[model samples]
Target: MVVEEREITVGGDARPARFTSYDVEDFPVPTGREEEWRFTPLKRLKGLLKGADADGKVQIDVDGLGDGVTVTSIERDHPLVGSVLSPVERISAIAFAGFTSGTLISVAKRAVVEQPVTVTLRGEGGTAYGHLVLDVGDEASATIVLDHSGSATYAQNVEIRVGANASLTLVTVQDWARDTVHVGYHAALVGRDARFRSFTVTLGGDLVRLAPTVRYAGSGGDAELHGLVFADAGQHLEHRTLIDHETPKCRSRVAYKVALQGEGAHTVWIGDVVVRKAAEGIDTYELNRNLVLSEGARADSVPNLELETGEVEGAGHASTTGRFDDQQLFYLQSRGIPAVEARRMVVRAFFAEVIAKVPVEHLRDRLTGQIEAELEGSGV
Candidate 1:
């Protein structure tokens, strides 16, 4: 395959160009100096960047199979495997080339699924490669939850397709073991007049890096992406997002929040949005916020917005990283609340906006409990 490169002007400044290819050999070994790999700890990747062979397996399970849903296995060379996603980095390309078969979940046309579908992937140990695809037919509606657990070094790719006039709500939870290292790429293509909403929750793993990108297949498409990250001691969690507005009259919104505590806890968030010349009257915005709770913890946030045409409806980006607000804590303590409980309240309020938007009630309650547990364990 041919390598494609393009230059983009973001915030009136020329950013580094990016390339995409399907072949692993097209990408050079990252030296931790490139713009894309600068914030990542390459030494702790566990050889995923080198396209190492899988020595273990990841067991897959699915539940809530309804009237319109179909789940099956397909070969790597299946027609729909690479129809919606193209590899933009070495690890994703390596995963695409290494996996022999993948799981496909499809929804029939004009069907409505009342029950939410859940897919669980459990790892045994060692290294593994995997792929998954979710296809929503025209005029259909469905909700899906992808739950990840167990311990392993895993690299996977997920492709999603939303047909014309369809709606899809996807939530991906990463609750891996402390010894696991995971790197994944998720891409989605939204058809004309389609709606796509995604929520990503990252809470575990030693080193986890995930990239999610979206592209519009036709005009009048809408996309919204939300993420939550909580890192404990010695944990590294990173999320990179790209919203490419290539069609006219489309809209996109992105918001992500991070909370870091304990020594050596680190988090990174990169938000990139591009509006091509042909994408006239487009509206887009991205925001990222980080709160550091203790010493020896760090957070990095970068937001970029690019516009090729001046006829946009609105385009903007914002990123903020700082410690907790003293005034808020003081206000809570003055109300006769204990200091420890006040701190917990402040943290919960910080993440409440995102948590409240989750479509599942049980999931929202579970995530709240998990956040409380993190605060108690870290003695925040």
Candidate 2:
């Protein structure tokens, strides 16, 4: 279906509606005038917006493939690709046009995976384009972990399609180098009675932007999006999401938490949810909370909800940004903990609720350690 494609005002500039275009010609090079590029540091993008190619500079390595999972490296577009979502930005279109090969993952029907599929993308240097397509068979359940590290200017697209009654859990960890710049588009098509969960943790990067979109194909679909960001000195992190509720009896919940510290730290979160007139009896809500741990950090959060009809069950949005809880820190300090330790305790407690949901034990431990390290470096 063609989108309404309205433009909303942001900082006096117009922001394009969700699901704009899939063609490269439809998206032009952004000059930082568009609403999407206004918050991002386009000057630090390293010419990625001009449609740069990889030129054999980046390396993508994958490990930990569970049983009943088949992987393929296809150089051309497959039937399953582009089914759920399309490229809505210029760099994402460039990544779609200049990919060396597309990774295709297929899970067998009714197969339960014992281990999570881990894919590590190491950026040696230079610019690169890439894509990934995951097809989960009916009644199948699986977990995938996509990890990024090292230095590079990269753009890519990810599409996940779940069959009816299937379940998919995707965890993306962006642990890039302090000089890396990466942007990617991720979208999922949830089927009837299916469940989709997306968890993202952003730790290191000079500038990183992630866009995730969701659309329900049938009734009784459910989607949950959770994100964690820890930005330090001289880092810029951005995340935007779109949830399209076109079918009845579908539900979506979004929760993104972030912490900023040190000089030149910045983060942005944009949440857009649209419920069509035909989508009756739907339940959806979005929440974004930012914690400023230091003096020089900045965080921008916006949640937009558009409802065509009021026949839906419930719909709402919330956004909050503030400093640390001094009372919580005082409570910890009064309990015999040192001042620094008390601060660390408060920071950890802020993200403990989200970290505890990691189904992978070792990965959860790693995330906890990373959070603790961030707290130590915060100097708060």
- The most accurate candidate by lDDT is 1
The TM-score leader among the candidates is: 1
Candidate 1: worst-modelled 10 consecutive residues by lDDT: 9-18
Where does candidate 1 stray beyond 4 Å? Answer: 3-18
The TM-score, computed over Cα atoms with residue i paired to residue i, of candidate 2 is 0.93
- For candidate 2, the 10 contiguous residues with the lowest summed lDDT are 7-16
lDDT of 2 by residue, 1-380 (tens): 23246654432333345555656677777778788888999999888887765764557666777788988987755776667656778787778778878888888889898789888888888888878888888899999888888888888899889878999999999999899898988989999889999898998889999998888889999999999999998899999988988789999999999999989999999999988766789999999999999999999998999886688888999999999788987888889999888877777888898888878888899999999888866677
The TM-score values for the models, in the order shown, are: 0.96, 0.93
Q: What are the per-residue Cα lDDT tens digits for candidate 1 across 189-231?
A: 9989999999999999999999989999999999999999999
Q: Give per-residue lDDT, candidate 1, residue 211.
A: 92
Local accuracy by lDDT, each model: 0.90, 0.85
